[model samples]
Target: MKKHTYILASLLLVSGIALAQKENIKRANKLFKMKAYTQAAKTYETKERTQEVLQNLADSYYYNTSLQKAIETYRELFVKYGDSIDIEYHFRFAQALKGVKNYKEADEHLSKYYNKPVNTLEFIEANNKITPHNFKLKEIVNEGSSSDFGLSFYGENKVVFASTRNTENPSYAWNELPYLDLYTATLTNSNTLINVQPFPEAINTSLHESNAVFTKDGKTMYFNRTNSTRKKTDEARIAHIKIYKAELINGEWTNVTALPFTSNSYSTEHPALSKDEKTLYFASDMPGTFGSFDIYKVAINDDGTYGEPENLGETINTKHREQFPFISEFNVLYFSSIGHQGYGGLDVFRSNMVNGGFDKPVNLGNIINSNLDDFAYVIKEKDNVGYVSSNRTGYDRIFSFSREENPLTKYLVEGVVQDKNSKKLLPGALVEIINQSNKTIKDTVVGENGYYVFKLEPNKLYKIRGTRQAYIEQELEFLTGNYGKSHNIDINLESLVSVEERIHQNEKGELHVQLDKIYFNYNTSEITNEAAKTLDVLVDLMKKYPSMKVEIAAHTDARGSEQYNLNLSKQRAALVLEYLVNQGINKNRLKSVGYGETRPLNKCIKEGICDDEEYDINRRCEFTILK
Candidate 1:
């Protein structure tokens, strides 16, 4: 009985395989025709599936859905059979690899056919994050209007966008696009916008026109337009739109024309053009879409026309529509979408092509995106400011976003470097600025008067190394905390160490330490935000050597009453000492000292320098380590 049951089960399995085999070939062909590659791929996977069936299975799955499975099937089927075929499958298979983010391998294959442009958007974006700060956002591009969309650099001249302005319905509260057209504003050489206006004649139609990208040479333009509508044909229900391109001939734009490879029955628009005018990105609801209106890329062929569109894949697309693509000069793609998780409505996002696939798309975040509809953004290379078109305001307007480049401290570092021997200013010496990470962040040549200035955030340890060829390098460290008062700490560096003397090695050497000056504001004990930043540098060094003791001192320029100045300086030093104590430094290791008018370096008419700024030279405070 057990043997009979095993035989029966084997028969059933064999019958199922046989049934799968016969129709599998038929199903593969049917799906190939209908472009349902993913569903047909399962049947074609059986061992009994025919060569004709599996080859079609590979092509269908690969081309229609993605290249990952297509590569596998093509490699397997190609191995089984030599390359005698009715169609060129390998070329598309390579493009499929590129479509799926297997770029290096795809490039290996693409080199056999095409030379890809160098994508530098990733580098541009990386440096965008690596560099310093940004200017503040100032004003709106449009004070009124509610229909602006899509912004582009107008070829070293201005920014062009889509708007429903100054059109028919001139008295209408708003001029929305039925025949929407191109508008522009001048962009200053510094990337500022001015003298905004609209493009006339050929570029502007009575229909919807947006998604404009210019060729690098600035003579050609590719954009989207709604040609005509069809009724319920492949997701178009008398409401489908299309895309088009136009050329700037001589000094005028030619009439717009529809793009090639678009079917009459499907909805397509939102075109993104490559800098070389050879590649494009557009949105379509064509057959075999992974989700609603997936983003697709197409390459320009030898004849100067577009090839079959390749879907950008699931990485940058979601079930929601992704449109208005902007490929930065560096190949970083910026697009707006409703699909991915966002704060609300549509948000602008940027993605970089990395390792043959895309890095995760980054939400330009709250700084650029708003809860209301935000779309159509373009970034300037090597700049932190970008222009975005949105209806976030009560009306449609262009908003400029100033991106903060770095998040460092905010205190100004000002001091003088003097020669220890003659107490004369050292002119033209390089002042090297070092951050806490020990990276040489910046270097400035000292002015002819031997003064240097640097700005940093409060709460950091900075090392200032002053140098000249004939003189030994002099290094000074400072911890700037929250001191409400101004600083007048002038540093005087010494000569080259004498050969017989390892002077700096012995921390106890006389010239090893000296106080140039102490700084304070007029009658203030509260620390300024600038002082807070510089004090942090001091905190780090003192913590580096737990046994070091220091005296916090205050001095007054020779202008005030002797007794009052002494008390005021003492109170000021005590306030600073209290701050250090609160920062966890031992109180027993610190002392407060006040030196009134008695220590003025400059001899004055009445034992003081005569003028306020010079008089300010003596009113200061600082810390000196006591060995």
Candidate 2:
């Protein structure tokens, strides 16, 4: 009886421990939902490795940029629940792998998730060639602040930035840092922040505020403000953010109010103003969003009213997060996106405004973008300076950069296309830059001035080709010098007038290539040995000018019925064309036509109207150059 009582006691102890573990898991989940990633990660570490627990743990580490731990946890989760895991987990796992520069393994998962091959290295290399500018970055020196970002210019001398430097503000649940507040400061020439002071109670609130933009006159401002309460959505409860505008009146900010387009159900943040201050750009996740967050724009009218918000569309949005939009003075859109194929996390991208709409976005390349979150890019285009925010060093830090034209892009070839003999500019000519591998890097048609330019890379072998209709193609092979060096390579295309002279015009005034008489056997369309030799000359000419097109015409005597003569001539012309194709001429460049007895060199229009010599003159083949 004592042994039985001991067993019951052991069972109760096991049950009590299991209940305690369950309670711990519940607490961890609540923290995770609250976005207290750091605290949740520690709590989850002590829980059982169920799929749900492991997924949350890995994501917690990933969100906090603790990539190594995230990678390790993700590996275990995939190995244990490979088929059951959601595809989105693969993307996060790949991002974690890439954060540590493990691109090879990360690409495997990305390829599976995207259903296509993704080579981050290739992307970087390609972007380097076209990214117009290279950046020289210097991290801004912040005093007594561990996190600060979203630096924007204010009134030419002062700068406005968001920071978590206020120790008295309530701690944020996301990172356990103080809630963000807007601060104004003087950015020193040596990249130091000085005279830093928070905005008055009008702009800086107890809740999170960030991403401020100011008007040129410094009379109007727009910034982000997180909601005081969380609203439940399809996935979880989220604290939606809104854009607020404040007017600087009588040396104090007043009339602070949320934009009408903002709502409690969705977020609208990161406001940017156009050069004319006529349009406002921001990031939002409201209805009709293509992804988690997309860049949106609304026009600011003359009376301060806003037009209907417009999404930037698929060209600038994706099925992932795109935020922190900054429109430069030149109307170029610079935004951060994780949806577009990037190094790993949010990378800065630029989209030019062409024809009054944003074009395709291009990654800013590796110098400014890291394999971690880099966002909040603001730039002054004319000044060639900018500021960007990044979390590459485990904390959000602001960086100021000076931009210069890329040296590789500076190494260019420019010249004019001219007529070789006439010394005249050959407008509408095609100028192509081909690499050593015979791949065309760039091509352009010269305008009225016959001038063209192509950007080049250093230490590369390239050939410049100039081509025009009825002209002999001119190609010059050259090697590129070092960066900042350029070449003037004028392409002088020679006209094919000499070749055209050999082409005689028929009595009908149609141009036809004059070759030696081709003789086929009597009553048969078979190509004779003598005919083959004559056709070889035409083959050689087409080969010399690859762009040349030819049409072979065969005419027969009018002795037979016209239909019979037409059929026989077509067979003869087809045979000659077949021979030319066999000799390596592109079939597309060759055409065959049977004039039959309809066209005659002499007045032999009907049977017995002329002698054998007149009939023989009509029964000959003529080659025509189509192009």
Screening candidate 2 with a backbone cut-off below 3 angstroms (N, C-alpha, C), the clashing residue pairs are none
Candidate 2 worst ten-residue window by lDDT? 497-506
lDDT of 2 by residue, 268-370 (tens): 9999999999999999999899869999999999998999999999999998999999998878999999989888899999987755788778788887899
| lDDT, candidate 2, at 573 | 96
Model 1 TM-score (2 dp):
0.43
> Model 1: runs farther than 4 Å from truth?
1-139, 169-179, 187-197, 233-237, 406-627
lDDT of each: 0.64, 0.89
Prediction-by-prediction clash tally: 44, 0
lDDT of 1 by residue, 152-212 (tens): 7767656787766645622221122234677777755554546766666677665567767
